[model samples]
Target: MSYLMMFYSAFFSTSVSASETAATANPMRSQVVADLVEFLIEAGQYLGMKLEQGSMSYQLFALGSIFLVAFASFILAKLILHFKVLRLVSRSNNTWDDCLMEAGVFRRIARIVPGIVVYTTYSLFFEPEDKLYSLLANFSAIYLLFTAWRTLSGSLTAIENIYSRSLLAKKAPITGFIQVTKLLLTLVLIFLLLSLLLGKSPIYLLSGLTAIAAVLLLIFRDTILGFVAGIQIAANRMFNTGDWIAMPKYEVDGEILEIGLNVVKVQNWDKTISTLPTYSLTTDAVKNWRGMTESGGRRIKRSVYLDIHSVSFADAELLEEWEGMKLLNQYLKDKKQELVEDRKLKEIEETDILNCRRLTNLGTFRAYLTSYLKKHEMINQDLTCMVRQLKPTEIGIPLEIYCFSKEKNWVAYEQIQADIFDHVLAILPVFKLRAYQRVSSHNEQAQKNAQ
Candidate 1:
C-alpha cells in the first residue's frame, strides 16, 4: 500500500506536466488511473490468476484501495485527536473545553475529517469520467451532509450546556429553543437528502412538496404548533424549569420538570406527572408563583368569620379583663383617657352606651390582632399587615387577616398560619367573641350537648 501510494504520487507528478502539453494536442483524460489498474492487474496475474483490465480482480483491487485509504485516514485523525488534542483539552482549566467534551464536539468534528479526505482523494483513485466517480461523489456528499448535521447538533448541545450555568437560565430556559433548532435542521437535511437521492433539484422537490401540503400539515400539526409555541415561550420568559405554575384547567399545580419542543412536563405536588402541549401553555391561563417566590414572601390571605351576636360593648368587667392582656394595655389606657376627656368637655351623658364613646370587644380584638401580628416573627411587616372587616355575610362578619408570611415554604407557611388561627380561636372566648360555625349534622348534635 505504501509503495502504491509512492508510485501513485510519482505517476500524478508526471501526468500533470504531460497533461498540460496533451491539453494543447489532445484530450487530457485521466489515463493515469487506467494505467495503475493495468499495473495492479499484472500484479494480480503474477499470483496465479489470469487478470484483465476492468475485470473482477482489477475492480476489487481498486475498491479495496479506496476503502483502505478512507479507513486509514479516519483512524489516523481519530487517534491523533483522542490521544493528543482532546486529551489535552479535557485537562485544561477552561470551562468551555469541558463543555465541548460532554457535547462530543471533538468526536463529531473528527468524524468529518475522513469524509473530507475521501471526497477530495476519490478523483486520484478513479478516473474522473468513470461510472464509479459519480457514485463516489454522491456518496461523499451524502456523508458530508450527515456529518455536518451531527456537528451542528453537537455544537448546539455545547451552547445549551454552557448557557444553562448562567444566572439568566433560571429566568428563561433555552432547552426548548435548542430542540426546535435541531428539528428544523433535521427537516432541511431530509429535503436535501431526498433531492440528492432522486437526482432532482431542491426547488423542484420543494415545488412538488406543496402538492402534499395538506398531508404534511396533518402529520406535523403538533410539531408545528410546538415549534412555534416553544419559540414564544422561551422568548417571552413565561415559564422555566423549577418555576411553580398553577394551571387549574390542566390540573397542574407544581413546578416545571422539563420544557421541551413538543411537550412541557410538570411534576405535580401530588406526585403525578402532567404532560401539557407546548402550545397550550401560550393558549391557556397559568398562574406563575415565580413572583411570590422571587419577592421573598407568600401571601397569607385568610378570613375567620366572627359571629355578630357575640360582639358586645366593653363594660367595667370586660375592660378590666382587656387591661390584663399585655398587647392591648397601652391602647386601652389611651382610649379610656380619650373617652374621659370627651365626656368632661362635651357634657355628654355617660349612661348612654351608643352616644358616648365606649370600647367594643370587636374593636379591641382588631387592635389586639394588629399588635400581635406586628410583633410576630413570621409575618412580613415590610408589606401590608392589617385585620380588615369585610361585609357581613349570611354566616357572620368576616374578619380577614391580610398579610404576607416570612416563611415561604409550603409546609412551614401552613404551620405558621395554623398556629396563628389556633391561638386566635382559643382566646376568642375571653374577649366575648365567637367564630361563626356552619350548621351541620355534627354541629347540631354538639349544640344539643351544650344545651
Candidate 2:
C-alpha cells in the first residue's frame, strides 16, 4: 500500500500546481489516478501479494503463523490445566478442587483456551467484513460465554459441597441460599450476553424491567416465598435436616431429607417420600420430634380399664395378705399403719369403712403402678411420671399410665410399654382387682349352667 500512497501524493501535488497556474484543473485526471491505484491494489490482493513481495509468501506464512500460534496456545493451556494445575490440585488434601472435579469445573475451564485460539485465529484468516470471520468470532464468543457459565455453575456446586461438609452447614444448611444465588448469577449472565449481542447497556434493559415487576414476582412467587422461609427456618433454628416432623396437611410424617428453595422433601417411616412447599413449614403447624428426641425419651400415654365392681376398700385381712406380697409389701405396711392411726385418732368405728380414709384395692393398684414405674429401668424418672385415674365411663374407670420411656426407638419403646402393661395386667388379680372386660356369651352360658 506504500507504492499507492507515493503515487497518489505525486498526483495530488501535480493537480494542486495545475489548479494554481491554469484556468481549469482536469478532475478526470485526478479520478483516473485514483481508479488506477485502486485497481493495482485489488490485482495485487488477488495474486496473494504483500507490500514486501520477496520478504515472505503472505498467505502461506500468515496462515502458518496463525495456526502455529493458535496450536501453541492450545497446547500450553492443555498442559497447564491437565498436567500441571489439575495434577497439583488433585494431589492436595484440600477438598475444594475435589469438589470442583466432581462438579466438572476444570473440564469446563479447559474449553476457554481452545475458544480463545479460535477467536484470535479466525480474525487473522479473514477480513473484518467477511461473514465467515464474523460467524467464527461470534461462535467463539458464545462458546467462551458458555464455558464461563459452566465453570460458574460448577464452582457454585463445589461451594455447596464444601459448605455441606462443614460442621456449621450440617447444623444450619445453606443449600437453598446457594441455589438461589446460582439462579440469580445465571440470570445476570444471560442478561449480560443479551446486552453484549444487542450492543445495548445492561442498565437500560434492566430499567425496562420496571414495567414487568409484577410479572416477575408472579413467576417467581414460590421461589421468593421459599427463600424467605428458608432464611427464617435457618435463623430461628426451627428445623434441621434429620428432624422427624409430622405435617398432616402435607401428609408428611417423616425425617427431613432436604430443604430447598421451593420444596422440602421428607422420607417417611414407611419408605414413602412426601414433598411439601417450603413456606408451609413456616406458616403452617407441623409437629417436630426434636423436643422428644433431645429429651432422650419417648412418651407412653395409655390407659387400662378397671372393673368398677371389683373396686372395694381393703379390709384388714386383705391388707395383711397384700403386705406379704413382695412388690406391695412395703406399700401396704405403710398405708395400713397410717390408716390405723387415722382411724384411732378420729375415734371412727373400725367396722364402718366409709368413716375413714381406707385404701381401696384400686387405689393400691394405682400406688403399685407408680412405684413400679419409678423403679423401672426403661422409664425416665426425671420427667413427669404418674399413674392416675380418669373419670369413670360406662366401661369402667380408666387407669392411665403416663410416663416417659428411656428408649426413643419405635420398636424398643413399644416393647418396653407392652412389657410394663403385661406385668400390670398379670398382677391385677393379686390385689383382688379385675380388669374391665365385656361379658361374652360363653361366660353368660357358663353362669346359667352353674345356676
Candidate 3:
C-alpha cells in the first residue's frame, strides 16, 4: 500500500497539491473524526457513490453507522466475555470469580465496553451539532446507567455469598446492610435515569420533590419504619434466619425463612408461611429460642395437681413402709437426722406433729422428684433443676417441676417432658397421693373408674 501510494503521488503531484490546498482551505473541518468521515465521502465519490455532507445519503450513512456501531459493539463485547472470560471463570478453582460470573457482574461489566464505544465515538457517526447526537447520547447514558446499576447489584450479591462462608455471618450478618445499600443505589439510579430522559438536572428534580416530602413520607411510612427496624435487628443481632420465634399476637410460631427490608417471612411448624412487617419485630414482643438452642437445652416448666386431703405427716408405719423404697431411703434418713437435731435444739415434743419437724407425704414426694430430676439422663443437670410445691388452688396443691431438658429440638424436648410427667403421675399413688380430677358427668366417672 505504501509503494502504490508513492507511485500515485509521484504521477499526480499537481492534483495532490490542489487537493491538499482545498482541504487546508476549509475551516469547518477540524476534528480527526470529522476529517476521517469526509475522507470516506470523497473515497465513495471515486467508487461511483454520491456521499455529500448535507445530502440525504450522508444522513442515511450516519444513521446506518449508528446501528452498526451499537450492534457490533454489543455483540463483540458479549462474544469476548462468553467465549473467553466466562469459560475461564467457570472452570477456575477460585470460587469468588465464579460467584461474580454467576451473579452477572462480569457480564454487565462487559456491556460497558459497548457504551464506551457509542458515547466516545459520537463524532465518528454524527456531527457535534446534529440533533441525532442528543438522541444517541441519551440512549447511551440510559444504557450505561442501567448497566452500572446491575453491576453494582451483582457485586453486592457476590459480596454476600463470600461473607456467608465465615462464622461471623451468623453473629452479625451483612445482608441487611447490603440490601439497604442496594436500595439506596436503585433510588439514585432511578433519578438519574429519569433526569436523562427529561433533560433536567437530578438535583433540580430532587429539590422540587421536597415540596411533596410529606406525601412521600406518608406513602413510605411502613418502609421507613421497616428499614429502621431492620438496621437495629441486624446491628443488635436480635434474630436471624432459622431462628425459632414465637409471636403470639401474630400466631407466628416457627422458624424465620427470610428477613427483608419491609417484611419478615416465617415458615410455621405446619409448613404454612407467615409474613410480618419488619418493623413489627422491633415494636412487638417476640420470644426468640435461639439462646436456648445455642445453649443446647430446652426448659421444661410444668405443674401436677395432687389431692390436698391425701397429704399428711408420715407416721412410724408409713416410714417403715417407705424405708423399703430405695429412692426415699436416703431422703428419709437425711430428713430424720435434720428434724431430730432441730427438735432437740428447740426442745419440741416429738409426740405433737405440729411442734416437731417430721416428714410429710408432700415433702417426701417433692424430695423424690428433685432427686429424680437430678439423676435423669435427659435432664440438663448443669442448669437449674428444681421441684417446688406451688400455692394450693381450689382443686389441690400444685407441685411444679422446673428443669432444663438436654434435648433442644421441639419434638425430642416434648417427648422428654411427657415421659417425665407420665412416670410421675403413675408413681403418685406409691406415696399415698392421688391426682386431682373432676368428673364432668356420670359417664366420665364410670370411664375413669374403668381406666
TM-score of each: 0.84, 0.79, 0.83
Query: Per-residue lDDT for 1-451 in model 1, tens only?
Result: 3453354233323223443464446433446545666676776777776766545565566667677778898899889988998889977988777888899988888889878877766655554455676677678878988998999999999988888877888878888789978987788788777867776656677779889999999988988898888788778888889999999999999989888888999999998999999898899999999899998678988999998878988889998888899999999889989998998888887887667888899999999998999999999899889999899999999998988999999999999999999988988998999899887574588689999
Each model's lDDT: 0.82, 0.77, 0.80
Error of 3 at 100 (Å): 1.9
lDDT of 2 at 305: 93
Candidate 2 residue 415 Cα shift, in angstroms, is: 1.8
Q: How close is candidate 2 to the true structure, as a TM-score?
A: 0.79
Q: Once model 2 is optimally superposed onto the true structure by TM-score, how far is the C-alpha of residue 52 displaced, in angstroms?
A: 14
Steric clash pairs (candidate 2): none
Measured by TM-score, the strongest candidate is: 1
Candidate 2, run of 10 with poorest lDDT: 8-17
Q: Which lDDT tens digits does candidate 3 get at residues 1-451?
A: 3453354234222223454464468645445657767776876677787998756677666666666777798898889899999889878998888788878898888888877777665545465456676666777667777888889999999998877766777776666677878988887787776766776655567778889999989988987898888789878999888789999999999999888778899999999999999899999999998898899578999999987878987889878988988777898888889988898899887787877777888889898899889889999888999998898999888999999999988788899999999999998877889888764464476688999
Pairs that collide, model 3 = none
Candidate number with the higher lDDT (2 or 3): 3
Positional deviation of residue 317's Cα in model 1 after best superposition, in angstroms: 1.8
lDDT of 2 at 267: 100
Report model 1's TM-score to 2 decimal places: 0.84
lDDT of 2 at 307: 80
In candidate 2, residue 107 scores what lDDT? 74
